[model samples]
Target: MNIDISKEDFELAPGESVLIHTNEFIKVPNTLSACIYERYSVKSLGLMISPAHYMNPGYKGNIGLLAVNHSTVPIKLIPGIKICQLALFELTSEPLRPYEKQGGKYMDAKSASISKLHLDAEIQEFLKSKGVQKASDDMAKELGEYLMGHIRASAKRLADILRAEEESQKNG
Candidate 1:
């Protein structure tokens, strides 16, 4: 769906992130799933969407995008820009139970949702079996730290490359 990001245009300071809703609401069939991706052009602008790209079958909702600014300066997200795309794939076979039938927490979600993984019965059971009730929280913190560190390092490397290019041009 084509959407105008004009009114929704947002600025993200370096290292900052925000959740943005897609202009389109999607409905997936039980026999199909989708992978969400950021448009390649956006990468050149120093913005990235989280890599959690998988969309479950039987989902009906507006996609929520986690936008991050990795550049040293703030990045302005303009409306009307093709921020993301969806690649749909056919499943080998339909599941006996689809997400909607199973009471998926994110069913019909209109906006980006925080993780509801903790509410999954299997996850709860696994945590109970492992005696690690706080695992989810701990894992989230660790993952955030790891990702931020990498982003910082990548930004530094890009800056270094730019500086080198400038110097080479001056001498050439």
Candidate 2:
């Protein structure tokens, strides 16, 4: 890990997310993988939501995260919040090639964005095609609530699956 970064350099206001740059952005050597972990210490207990927690090998440039404080209390983000760590490992071969050649969804994410997921027109169209229409002005409020509830349940199911996998990996 021939890289350099510090917390003071990534200073943040009470509610802000800044791109913490690194000294060198290694290319993963085409034969290694990196695992990023968000180093947060709090009693989250499924109540607080952290930022994204994975960065694959072959990713370029300084890694940035779209972190936010989900708790009611204001949390100051010091530059060295230990936001994340990139664990490097030698891979048997290049992992699935570069993102561009793989044509994955995040192939075009040149930088970190704080945008909502599924807010793209392409996704909206897909949802509409699946019969999720915006109700009339009179029904808009109620319809929004209903949709939110459904989405929350779906997200809960996804979280459950992820938790189960993590637990199994720890035990087995």
Most lDDT-accurate candidate:
1
lDDT of 1 by residue, 78-142 (tens): 76678787899999999888889988877888877556676688888887899866556457557
* Collision pairs in model 2: 7-79, 7-80
List the global CA lDDT of all models.
0.80, 0.51
Native-to-model Cα distance after best TM-score fit, residue 163 in candidate 1, in Å:
20
* Model 2 weakest lDDT span, ten residues long: 1-10
Among these predictions, the greatest TM-score belongs to: 1
Candidate 1 structure, TM-score to reference: 0.66
Q: Candidate 1: deviation at residue 114, Å? A: 2.0
